[model samples]
Target: MTTLRIILGDQLSTTISSLHDIDKHNDLILMCEVNEEAQYVKHHKKKIAFIFSAMRHFAEGLKKKKYNLLYTKLTDKENTGSFKGEVKKTIRQHHINHIIITHPGEHRVLEDIQSWETDLNVSLEIREDNRFICSTDEFTKWVKNRKQPRMEHFYRHMRKQKTVLMDDDKPIGGKWNYDTDNRKPPKSNLTIPKPCSQKPDQITKEVISLVNEKFKDHLGELDGFDLAITRDQALKALENFLSKRMPSFGDYQDAMLEGEPWMYHSHISTYLNAGLLLPMECVKAAEDAYLNGSAPMNAAEGFIRQILGWREYIRGIYWLKMPGYADMNFFNATRPLPSFYWTAKTDMNCLKQSISETKKNAYAHHIQRLMILGNFALLTGIDPKQVSEWFLIVYTDAYEWVELPNVYGMALFADGGYLASKPYAAGGSYINKMSNYCKNCEYNVKKKTGADACPFNYLYWNFLAKNKKKLEKNHRLAMMYSTYERMDEKTKKQIKNDSLQFLENLT
Candidate 1:
């Protein structure tokens, strides 16, 4: 029987499970740059270019391995623009009798794959995606009978199971997390090492041209498009981070600096999410770094936790509660996202800095995403669906599985604290402490209520007050509510009025 193995854009790794049993000379390896995936949410132009270039490179690698491949470019006239349409076309052309596909990363895509057996009249084998440390079945089993699936507990389980950061059955240094040690504020004159970049190869240049012509009106410009497209380049990036950035990375992982977008960051999320870098590979390298004394324990452990712990847990929560999880809106926040999010025209300096960097580079570290842009969206009551799409559209590292839980649960608390224990709401004071954004702001960070006051200050309190009924019982938020309650009646009213005026004026 003729067999066709389909590889999705994110499944660019040769080690991907679907390719394991392939008959190199007979079975056709099919890869397509379909229109439907690219235009799903008007993804950033650079993201389109990045994925397309990487896909093309991966296809070339397959051909080099003597694998019979059917690669479909986007501009091909026979391209049908949808995965199903392309698959049907391929079946007709090749007269394939059977198909094999690794499970996709998104629910909608998975739902579409479910119909292939009935719709195409072919035997379909959907292989388990073994790239993830936690499979869907594994996560489902782990979540059983648990009221709240906490990431820390899950992290510890993964640590013990994988033997990562462990010393003879116990966690290394008697701790599974060094997150507390990783939160040092940005120190003055901190000279951060910049991340490594790769110049565009011919394949990438062609893809960039295609994205420029096809997705001109997309979120970001591809002017200086630079990212590792192949596995070797991705490994180089890992080495660069270990040697240059990893030492300071743990110290200021949470700290943000004005004009320094790549401060002590791995900048490897795009690579990791794309399958160019495997999770355990990155985790092991960091572990090796600490073992050899090239990097500190906190630095290595913090990096390992993000990939082995949080990244895996986020994927688990996504699969565990999806389809319905996307629709959840616990607070029923209905405010429209302001245009400034798109144009980065906001008067709030922190928002402007974060959004501007996002628009330029399709990136912002976790703090900027959580404490600044996301905090604003939550405080201003922007619709969760709208905010989620904005994040998906603007970030190169964002896939539905990873992005959804972060936005719905971690950022907006829209899933009723399913993924996070409490809402990640924060006022301007937090931003001022972590970043230099407040130094040049037009609005005073210290002011709580007025036109000249930082909007986050009043909006933070206003969010707590508005959601008092829903969040009052949350133990984590008790102190915030107590602080809000201690304010005099007049102060409360002024805060309400100021928040109303500020939100009303937002456009």
Candidate 2:
């Protein structure tokens, strides 16, 4: 007469309300590690290690609280390599009549869970996932009667609703967003305080060894995998960020320095994404720092936007237009992902820094992913599927629900401007203005129409010119494309030739 409650690895919040009403005497918790998730995208070795280790820890914690737990290890002999198979076997063995689960993050997994209802006699009850600040129902309600869905408007609404960065029904500092102040370039000879690093203990090291042996050919290295695997450790990482890093996190969040990987970034995305830490707690910590005058308003506001604004917004977009969202390709791009992407051997200093850091740590800050590597892929028309696959495999915090909208819509503009207002397409000048990579590059950032010229120069203009018919109707891009049409034919041809040759070498 036991009811089984299934908890996915990402749903590890100790304070989950779904567990509140559970009768521990008659209910049991089931957590499993299936091969389908691990092999889906060749996940980073550290990412796999992080999840397995965290799940093991969570299961142990639940056991101490006198809760009946059925934990399935990945290397278990009975493992069927799929969630459906595992659930079916468990149901038969336990003779469970009712199955309760919190909502899954990905649309595919949600559908798979739904399929189980008719196949078994068990009543499947799904509780809403309340980890995010904005509920799916609330977001849908906000957009139920809207024509154009802009993130800015949505972000403002969130700010007011959450009472974050607001002052008595008005935005603080007379501005709702401090993003303009947050985009300053890195200062010369800046003394960046070294961030804290965690050393793997026995449990974490064992998980790392398993990942190395099992996922040997994955995208990232396992040597430097020092992420938090328990809630206590996650709190330490969060405290270290607010005290040592958050003060400068806003000023240089977008700035990329040579050979400096952690430049004022919190580096806590791995912990938050893995469910070891909750978003509300993280947001509260930032707010506390600001109220105490330990961190500036700009810094606190910027960090909150990343969490409550972009993070929540992307999740909403994924659920709103999914099931067929992964196949979007507005550009019809056919180019292979550049070979240099796999190896950090590019002449472009920006790409080199971004790629090399990602290879070592399996992470890069938001700007590095969006501006350098992502911008290059979008401008060159590399297949969005290929780019999205790379993103899914290479990051420590990559879950399809989060990675898809960010890469396919925001990065590649493959969804025809659904998640973004317009393409974040830009030439090398933007990179040069924002970073010091341009100073150390072999190609000339200023040159526009030759082999010696920076590829971004031609590719940026060519992307606009080639996709003009597709993008001309966008009001934000009208003036930009109008100028392209009036340009002399000879100039346009030379730019196109340069872009073509660079793309040829890129593949």
Candidate 3:
């Protein structure tokens, strides 16, 4: 009756039901650091350090609870650097007859495990990942016959089903979304909330050294990295957000400021993505803050939607259409990502700031991701797969399942109208409206066709022109084209020429 349990880095949940009834004497738990995961993309140094440190911390916690454990450090010399290789070696050494695992976050990893079952003569059983509020089956049931799986509709249903922010089974404040109230532009005198940070412990310091030695060529800085790795530390991060930050989260969640890394952001995504903090716990914490009159309803509801609505909905969409989902490219874009994306050396002030911050901290708020980097990629027609891979690697909060849908589907609109009704293509005005980065830009945000014209303006029109045949059928996109039709031919030709010049320089 010998068994082995495999725990992936992202599946470090202590409450996972897979570990419920432990025959610890007969069963061994296996955890490994695989290069296949890191090499999938050139991940930021901070991201690599974070996952490794968190995994090591979780392993230590499990040992303190007296579980039979087999953990691999990144520096383990004999490691084969692949999950299957490590698992096979463990099975032979331990004489394990069966292996149990929680379902992986990505389908590729799941398929890899499935491919090995017949050869090993061992049963590989995968339990559900219960950290999510809704199960895959539940989401599938909700989308059974729907022609389109729009997230807002699904979000409303989730609200009703879970009774989150409900009054007598009806939505509180009589509205399904308070998004309109959450989009205020940043003002000159706004008071910014201080971000939460956990001081590095001995284990995290070792992980930093491991990353420095092993991944010296990676993209980001390792010197300024510090994140919560333990449950108590994670709880404190949650508390600080509730008490100090959540009240202003809605006011400026969409607004970007200069020299500010965290303006009313929770900074809890790292913990939540790492399994150190559960999403439901965060949702409840926000709800309690609203109920106690410690935070405004707009801020509470907005923060809750990001978790219970957006985070949950994206996970469902990712699982529903994957394996082939990564290849979706509606625009047929073949361009490589601009070199400035990696270097952060551009005259466009917004992009420069966002990318420099990404290089510094290996983190950016959701708006920065969607609007700055993702927007530029979408408008410029960069390869969807490359853009998606960049997103998967750059951030500490990224895992394939969460990162893919947001990057490919929501941000890039590469899913060809599956996750969104239309591409979120926009002219420079949208960026100007959202942030102060445009104020200091060399290119004028108002102009579209001259040398001093903003790149977003020309590229946006060019994007629409290039993809009109594909997008014309979408009702939401039809009006934009109709407006383009009214523009003089002279102006249209100038936009095309400017766009071509910009594309030429992109490479």
Query: How far in Å is the alpha carbon of 431 misplaced in model 3?
Result: 0.8
Which of the numbered candidates is closest to the native, going by highest lDDT?
Answer: 1
lDDT (Cα, tens digit) per residue for candidate 1, span 1-507: 689999999999999999997788789989999999999999998889989999999999988888999999999998999999999998989999999999898999999998988999889999988899988898898889989999998888889999998888999899878888998889878878777999999999999989989988888899888899999999999999999999877889999988888899898999989899999999999999999999998899889989988999999998888899999999998999999999999788999999999999999999999989889999999999999999999999989999999999999999998888999999988898898889999999999998899989999999999999999999999999999899999999999999989888984
Q: Clashing residue pairs, candidate 3?
A: none
Task: Return the TM-score for candidate 2, rounded to 2 decimals.
Answer: 0.97
For candidate 2, lDDT tens digit of each residue in 33-116? 988988887887878888998888888899999898998888899999888888888899988888889889888799999999
**Better model by lDDT: candidate 1 vs candidate 3:** 1
Ranking by TM-score: 1, 3, 2
The whole-model lDDT of each prediction reads 0.91, 0.87, 0.87
Cα lDDT over the full model 3: 0.87
Rank the models by lDDT, top first. 1, 3, 2
Q: 1 or 2: which has the higher lDDT? A: 1
Candidate 3 lDDT tens digits, 8-36: 98887888756767687878999999888
